[model samples]
Target: MAIELKEYIVAFIDLLGFSAMVQHDCERPKKEHRYIKVLYTIHLKTKELKKTIIGLEITQFSDSVVLAIPYSQENYKKVVDVISNYQYDLLNDGILCRGGASYGKHFSTEDFLFSNGMIDAYKIESTIALTPRVIISKELIDLVYPASELSKNEHLILESDGLYFINYMKNGNADDSWKAICKAIPDELSENPSIRSKHIWLIDYYNHQFPESKRKDNHRFVSPDA
Candidate 1:
């Protein structure tokens, strides 16, 4: 089989408590099988996602997963669908994932230009400690064109790169309690006036895999007022 080189949108999804999961297993090696089960499930889901979204490739390293997609709105939309479906399965099976994605030109070669998109995604994921949510780049939001507009739940808040806050539609509306708990942050930051760009992200709690305390990663980002 020959694989051709192409452009891609790279996404780095770091699970918040994945290190804790590994550490917990390290401290108690007897329960390693359970962690293996989780990893296996992730592997299966990644494969399925790849099959569903053409030009998508994924690999997992211990507690985190990296997904790459061909740079196109259609493919990115499918990627989002896969993420949403994965979230559904996690919720039904009692698991939560703190995920983040950035869309930009990526290559299949050794040399590539690394930017703040990846760092920002990780930072946002870290900042949401104790919460289950997916943080995405502003560049992505401009590309998503859903057939039917979804309703924004009270738990959802949209914050731009310049730190301007906007109330936007939520892709999924599962629980009212979840909405209330997630949407408690005020819109806008008066303290930091040196922000730029129009990028924003969606944050919420998954309630299935983890408690709210697991998402903080010591990153700096203005979060909703608790």
Candidate 2:
């Protein structure tokens, strides 16, 4: 079969701090830290999500994962949903995700793949998405109704940088995810300032997700309704 170029909303998600985590886990007992299990779960979730969203395409390598969906507001929303769900699920395992998404020409096959869309998405992830968040702007927002969708998306937040990021914790309800972060956050926050900055950004993101009416003046102080 011949490969043809298609416009897609592409997302490139890199697992933040995984390499460091892998090195740290090297000394720990294997039973205590299931790294292989984490990898398997990532692939399994990709399969599950692709099955649900028929047009979604996923390519994963090591700590990086790429998703390309047909260019449409509907598919874009699904892309956001996939990332949000992935963040929530991975958070349970003390994994953090950060990346970028955009729209452009892309194609990927079993034996071969090349995409400007992937490159652009990768650039955004590496540069713009410094924190543990997936940011989007420019082409995608103009091409699709991503900007307009913001008015309706509970999981989307526009930062001072004028880019939109997925507020993955918007749906978090203090379940296992909170427990995982509750431990991981303190450990990470105590690290060197460079490392501490990113985790701090995540903490702020989590605090800002809930509805305005549900929270008090302070970030940590929130009503049960939040």
Candidate 3:
């Protein structure tokens, strides 16, 4: 006989810039130290939120966390609220989040266990750019009205499938966070011959993702949330 299973909501929460943070730390490893500390804090906060918010079970991976929650009306709101709150708190620390939430079915059989409907959720999530925000599938939007608590940037939009993805970027309150980041880099390394090559690569990445106008206005767009 096949084992019974139930529908569920899968929440994918991915941390942004873990590898970049480490790779760029050669000049000043202390900066990386600070980044790791912030990550740990975020982890603890999410775990606490899971316990406080009913019907949610939080699981963590190397640079991400996936939460499987009971599929229900109230549970959906809880998930959104928790994530929004999480992002809001991290903004001050210069850390942002990219995440997706969708309801699906988790199957359990005699010889196998698997999930369905999560594929759509992931598809919707893929459309979100590197910003702090939540992306919800069309099915989820139809079920509950999204709150206007967070503003959407270029990465936020409604897909053809009617799924709505919102990218939230906020200004970080950390003192000289960006400046401190730059200061940590040694001038010798910054002026290295290979630095030009890396800058070119960075430019290519930005150009591919952002329009020339947005790229030129670096002051305003350097950080989406800011």
Best by lDDT: 2
True lDDT of residue 135, candidate 2: 84
* TM values, all candidates: 0.55, 0.83, 0.59
1 or 2, which is superior by lDDT?
A: 2
User: RMSD of model 1, in Å?
Assistant: 10.3
Candidate 1's C-alpha runs over 4 A off are: 1-7, 29-33, 109-120, 123-130, 143-226
Worst 10 residues of 1 by lDDT: 193-202
For model 3, residues 1-226, the per-residue Cα lDDT tens digits are 5555678777677765567665565456573555666677777887787676776666676777666677887877666666655655654455545677777886533344356644545554556423344677657666655456223434345434444554222222233333322332333334444443333333332333344323322231256675
Quick one: best TM-score, which candidate? 2
- Scored by CA lDDT, what does every candidate get? 0.49, 0.75, 0.55
lDDT of 2 by residue, 1-226 (tens): 7779988889999987778767767878877675667767766886677776888888878789888887877887778888888877777667778899988888888656688888999999998898888888577767666446667867678888888788777656645444656645664245476567777776666556533423222233467898
TM-score of candidate 1 to 2 decimals = 0.55
Candidate 1 C-alpha lDDT tens digits along 37-105:
675676677667767776777666666666777767677666766665665454433344556666654
* Best of the two (1, 2) by TM-score: 2
